[model samples]
Target: MTLEQARAALAAARRVAVLTGAGVSAESGIPTFRNAQTGHWARFRPEDLASPEAYRRDPKMVWEWYAGRYRNVTHAQPNEGHHLLAWLERDKGDGFFLATQNVDGLHARAGSERLVELHGNLSTARCEACGTVAPLPEPNTFTPPPTCPVCGARMRPNIVWFGEFLPELALEAATRAFEKADVALIVGTSGQVYPAAGLALETRRAGGVVIEVNPDETELTPYMSYSVRDVASRGLAALMGEG
Candidate 1:
């Protein structure tokens, strides 16, 4: 569909749900977990550093890796796509809900209030033992594994690690949004990831329209009512009539 058509659809929809992925943050210079700079340990697959077993076997390594990620994310600013989503949320009043698999916290930074961070966030730390949550200390000087001040338990980045479940509350919210939305805008995702990818199907099953924006055709393209081959920043701005 043309940009005008997409905008019209968005404007007419009563309830809209958005699902975003790493590509949405890439425009802001955030390196995805799979594409870290060469020669850095982060260049290794995220699965190697993001798992309960990994933290249990070598807590220091896990903490250092997450610290590096937190530093990188902190240095990056939210891109235009993030602002567009936030603007849509504000302008749409109660009709918009955003669910993202990225842990960068860019959505919140961009002022999107009704958002679910499905993968948790790197800006917070959680106690593995007591389930206590707190903002991670600034500068993250702890070597290797960090200790939680409240419970003296090992503090892990609040993100969902490999083999771990997504936060139940966030998942439930996302599911409800998908089930009730009249339009579902999927941006910047490969549509191969579980749960997040399933949202499009849920929307479709609920008789909602699916609009997908990606640089390439993802697995969900066949299921989309509208498909735009563009980055989220460009596509979403166009859809919101700001382009």
Candidate 2:
């Protein structure tokens, strides 16, 4: 649909749910998970480094990979898409919700309050044994791997790995938001990741108007009420009447 049509749909909606993927953060210079392997990491598979077994076999290596990612994400700023969503949340209050598959903390950094980080955030570390969560140490000081000071067990990035389940609370919250939304805004995601990708379908099935913002068509294109073919920042800005 055209920008004006998309904007009118958004403006008329009473409740809105927004789902974001790595594409949203790409504008801020953070690479998507699959594209993050480069330099010394080019030789290794990303899945090999992200699984629980990878940590059991080589904790230091896994920790190093995550540490680098954390450092990279920490330096990146939120893009206009993130800012616009934050504004929507502030304007709509309880009527707005955000669900994101990206581990980067850009949404929170951009001032989004009602949000679910479906894949977890890279800025925090979780104790594998006791489940305690804590902020990750600075990259330069994160040597010898991080150990849980409370349980003396290994600490892993607070991220969902290849075979792992998404956080339960986040999943439930996202589902509820999609179920009740008058409009569902999908941004930057290719719709390849499941469970998270399923939210768009859930919203559609629930009879909500689904709008997709991406430069190219995605698996979700067929389900969308409107597909805006533009990058995340530009697409979201246009939708919010900022462009």
TM-score of each: 0.93, 0.95
- TM value for model 2: 0.95
Q: Tens digits of per-residue lDDT for model 1 on 25-111?
A: 999998888776346683566677888888788877777788888888888999999999998898777889999999999999999
At residue 35, candidate 1 shows an lDDT of: 75
lDDT of 1 at 65: 82
- Candidate 1 Cα deviation (angstroms), residue 188: 0.4
Give candidate 2 misplaced runs (Cα > 4 Å).
Answer: none
State the lDDT at 10 in candidate 1.
Answer: 87
lDDT by residue (tens digit), candidate 2, 1-243 = 666877887988889999998889999999977789998898888788999889889988888888889989888999888998999898789999999998999999999989999889998889889999887777667664578879899788889998899899989999999998989999999898876568888888998889999999888898888999999988888788655
